[model samples]
Target chain A: MWHVDEGTMNAYLDGELGDRGAGSGERGAAERGAGSGERGAETVWEVETHLASCAECRALLERVKRVRDRAGEILASSSPDDVVAPPFEEIQARAEARSTGSRVLQLSRIKRLAWAATVVLAVAVGWYARGTVFPTRTEQVSAPLAASELEESAQSQEPGAGSGEQIAASGEPGADSREQGAGSGERGAEQAEEGAATVVAAELDRAVAPADRDVAGRGAAAQTQTPAEAPSTEVGAAAPPQAKAEPDAEVKLRQEVVDVSAQRRRSDAGDRLAAAAAPQAVVQQVAADEPGVPVGGIAVGEALMFEDSLWIAASEDEAQDALGGDVPVIPDLPVIDYWTAPLHGGEMVRVRQRLDEENVLELIVSRVVSDVRAAVALRGIAAEPAENEAQIAAKGSLEAVAIRRGDLRVVLRGPVSTDSLRVLGEKVR
Target chain B: MPTDWAVVYRETYSDLVRFLHRKVWDIDRAQDLAQEVFVRALDVDAENPRAWLFTVANNLARDEARAAVRRKKHLVLLKGEAEARAAGHADPHAESVEERERTDAVKRALETLSDTDRTVLLLWDAGLNYGEIAEQSGLKKGAIGTTLSRARRRLVEAYERLEGGHVARG
Candidate 1:
């Protein structure tokens, strides 16, 4: 049988002696021999024989027993008070506080967003109501005549025949004279008047002349022509009363022309007003369509007026179509009130000039708040300057301006004071 | 059914700390590590609470020792200074009650030889016999005799040196 070694002894004491303890066959046989508790057990016999014969080995066993006993005693005597524990309650409390704080912060953020949405919704509804309520105030006035009416009036006043002479000589002019002559000659005055009125109404009902047609074509061409030898000969010369009434006729005609001109001017002005108001309405409409954009306190500034180059290039209908179906053919939006907070830097004030989907320009005003002290310290300066130095530096410095637009809101920062903000409110178009 | 941790803590915390103190040289650190082991045990599946507590305490001591070795490598100067301060603080009380405790710990360490040897000694101290230790420690029954003999020889050698009036190196 193989003798036990120190490595094997260590492994066995450590309880790592399974499967690979030295000399498996001999060890198994020795275990069986010892297990029987026989007086002459093989393994016990060998160990006892060695202990009796070898003094060194026996001494080692005795020492091992003493050592084991001492170790047990030390382990038993050791006390529990030596170790410390972490304060778990404090950690748990801190964790709970952080969780509750974050939840509160999240709730507040949601509340703010909800308020902004409500404001935007109210503004959009108000704008739409205003547009629908006032219609006549937004369209232009035009004279109600057509081209066929003028032609019918001209045809009824035929001249040159003896009958036409009688018609012309009658006290009334043109169509009125024709009606008077027809009654005195053959027809009843009532019939003639009815016929004359019908013809005149029909003539007035004609289609409007093209705008390109000259004014001269509107007058009686036959009256302007003269027979040979009479350059300025007067017709119906004996009727001095008629001749005296000519100035009145001229005055009446001039009055009609002036009235038409004034009406046209009013119409043009109304159209321009409507055109000017359109983009503001469109911007409001777009803001309403998007659910997230803030509407309340969003003061719309005067729309920068530029003639739409594409609209000027194309016909009105094409321009209307290109702008999208939602934009009406005639847009009549009023100027919306808007404001932008200015960003103030040392001696420079910045304001937001314009805002669109993708671009923004800020107006920088220099030295606007020249007397006010800065409320906060400048970034990147480690030690705060002394009180005196701060006072000297505070001489109303304008800070850098930033113009920012996000998914929901737009902001402009500069040196604009509260008074300046109020003034800006008045100036918005 | 699992054992209740609150009961386990009430019953075994003192014993567990004492057991860990025997394993680790530093009693304060041992107590701290033992408390951590109990806290962990509170979360463990408790089929056998006592065994689990013992196992976890042993593992934590082993981990602490490995960490100490790593820490010693990085901050050698700091460690040496700390040890010196600790020794200086203990010097006045060395001949008093603390000295007896220290001697007892040294004697126990001498009793435990290799890691395997110490484990077996500890299992035995826990009142497990050779057969039970074979099952707990995965040792074969046949090899226990010879292995114990060699382990005993080493333990005796270690004890004799301590008994021979040799001072322990700090």
Candidate 2:
């Protein structure tokens, strides 16, 4: 007969013994006999018979029972809780607060991005307006005066005359009269030329004339000469008394034209100076707006118009020079549209081009600097026609608000379905 | 539907806290960790709230035990001169609290016997018969008589040592 080992007894205590106990010889035989499938007197009798005959096993069983009882007594007396638990509501509140805090933090980040976009747009608009208005006025007032000066220099150099020599001493480029024949034959051209000459001659006659008699009376008789008539006939037609009356007026008129011409030249020079300075200012502004972005090239498309200024497209080299370095040149960017507006002190020209399949690139140039400052590209697919129409009709709906703020782009990419884009647009923006 | 954490907290807070406190000796740490366990339990499916709570509480106790071993190494390093100085500066009331904490540690160590020994002992103490013990513990009915006898001897040995060998066996 095989006896139950200490380890087997321990395994029994731990409840790990399964069918292996059935193979342990006589004890197993007795257990098998006791398996009556009934919790009755017969089973107890068999168990008692086995135990009463086995003195050593009975002593072992009694010892196990005593140890089991002692251990239980120790645990029962020393029960775990003398301490209390914290309020359950407090923990629930903390979890809820954490969830809400994270949501608030996400919303705040979105708000900051919106504010940044607003600031960028305002600055771009302001910069573009500044370029358009001032330069246009400067161009207008200056060009006519320069043209008049050229005409005066040409008239001063009549080849044969000492008066022309005297006028040539003024250092004007057209002071040598080499083309007197060209001035005479074409009737319409000659008439226009003669009209300008008459105005100049009358002014000269008035300057040499005496101050007391009326210069206005002499000037009225001189106006009767046909523009097609010879310059000598017009000069001879002027009344001597009228010519003698307005010497000071002639000098004043001559001085006024010269000063106007000179002022225009100065303005042109100022424009060039401003143009030279504009790129640096634009770069500085762009840098200030987007720190750490290295600027390589600034280019504008030919169709660009910002406010009243017209911007012609620039070549890669010109754009590189403007940007101060060679940038990743995207050549032949298709022109989408232009915006013309009066702003700042000149014309503002903004040229938009499609940078890629998804992005629209906008380049803004100021007429004053003729320099491009910002180049922003909007990225994402254009909304479907139906969606756009719905968006428009939804006007002031949540969907419209989201599209206006570019939230629709994020919604489109989110796990939410395409339809959810419309819903999110309506709800979140 | 989400498991209602409030209801779970109300129903099982005391029992779970007591269960954990028995496993982990520090009442405050056990209570804090028990709340964490409940919060984790709330994520489980609601149909088995008791089973989920038991599983989570068991996991938390096991994790705390591992952490305690790590803490013991660090404490032993500080316990030499630095701890002596710290203890010396502590108030008399604080000293008494430390003494009570040490006694608690001794009691907790006695509770961590093997599952079979613990169950067997607990069943016997509860006055279960050999047949009931076999049914509860899954031991063979024939083996329960022998297993209980040995478990009793081991408990007596442990108890005598705990009492400093002064208490005589009845």
RMSD of 2: 24.3
Per-residue accuracy of model 1 over B31-113 as CA lDDT, tens digit each: 67766776566446766667667777788877777655533432332236676455534533235665655556554654558
Chain B: TM-scores of all predictions: 0.68, 0.58
Per-residue lDDT of model 2, residues A1-429, tens digit only? 233343334434444344323443213444432343212111233434445676765675565555555655555544443555567777767667656755654564465455446545544443343332222112211122343442343344232222211221221111111122221123233444444443443333233223211222222222222223323332223223333344444344435434433433333322322322234344346434433322211111111112113244565455444333332212465756544333222333344555345444444433222222222111001112223322222222112111222200111112112333333333321
Name the runs in model 1 displaced over 4 angstroms: A1-429, B6-11, B73-75, B78-101, B104-112, B127-132, B141-153, B167-170
Best by DockQ: 2
Poorly placed runs, candidate 2 (over 4 Å): A1-61, A81-91, A98-429, B1-12, B46-48, B65-156, B165-170
DockQ for candidate 1, please give it: 0.07
